[model samples]
Target: MKITGLMVYYYFVCHKKLWYHLKNLNLENESENVGIGKLLDETTYSKENKHISIDNVINIDFIKRWEILHDIKKSKSIEEAGIWQMKYYIYYLEKKGILIKKGMIDYPLLKQRKEVELSDDDRKIIEQVLVEIEEIGKKEKAPDNINSKICKKCAFYEFCYC
Candidate 1:
């Protein structure tokens, strides 16, 4: 079972989502919001700078100035997950001796950018999250969905609801 930056993202957003993802039950392809997000990711940056996969574990949106990693998002609605996702990227690279220290979340739609740093505390949290994510992957079935306001915004809304 591989833990990806996307798993890290969904772990924070919804454990049930993490489980479904681990099971390969993808709903993003059927999601209009996901389509828009993919479009933004593709067109917001230079194609050459996109989809930089690190050791096949994490797919970075791009790396800027040869050091700073950037993740382009459509909005800041789930910014916490974005921050942790960025931190996970930093942690993964550091473990591989890449030693990246800075990250930024670019919201081209809003023209906003948020800087992220990998603190010692964040590294510890990310390690714990990786463990939790792996455990979720090994579950017998997808965890029970927890309804929330964010559900409507999630690509898995239809799968979880109607």
Candidate 2:
């Protein structure tokens, strides 16, 4: 399976969700939180060019010129995941001969934004993550759910819990 920016985000958020996603057991369409996020993504950045898909692998929310990338979020509950997702975007573009200065994660609901920059160490970690994700994708069953508060808002909540 191709490693996507969303999959990279899921890797940090929940391994089970990542596995479910890897298996094509998609539940995002049945999610209310996801619906809200989609609404927010559409309405919040009306003026900006959004949903920029890179080689059909990653879909960046937008770009500020060609040097900076922007990703919008509904909240910062899994902020680290969002940060890593941004770093991965920077790394992906760099591998394609595009030099990105940095990335910004926009939490429109919280009225906050966090800036992310790719480091040599981050690139190494992302590389390892890609390998690990491949391993997860090969599993016969979905991994155990995290059973955290975050799960309540996740797209796979019902599938995992109910």
Measured by TM-score, the strongest candidate is 2
lDDT per residue (tens digit) for residues 1-162 in model 2? 678999999999999999998888898987888899899999988999999998888999999989899999988888999999999999989999999999999998888889999999999999999999999999998899888999888888888899
Compared with the true structure, all predictions reach lDDT values of: 0.89, 0.92
Tell me each candidate's TM-score: 0.94, 0.96
Reference-based TM-score, model 2:
0.96
Give the per-residue lDDT digits (tens) of candidate 1, residues 1-162.
667899999998899988888998898898888899999988887755689887688999889776899999999988999999999999988988888869999999999999999999998999899889988888997788888889988888878888
How much does each candidate deviate from the true structure in C-alpha RMSD?
1.4, 1.0
List the candidate 2 regions with Cα displacement exceeding 4 Å: none
Best by lDDT: 2
lDDT of 2: 0.92
lDDT of 2 at 114: 95
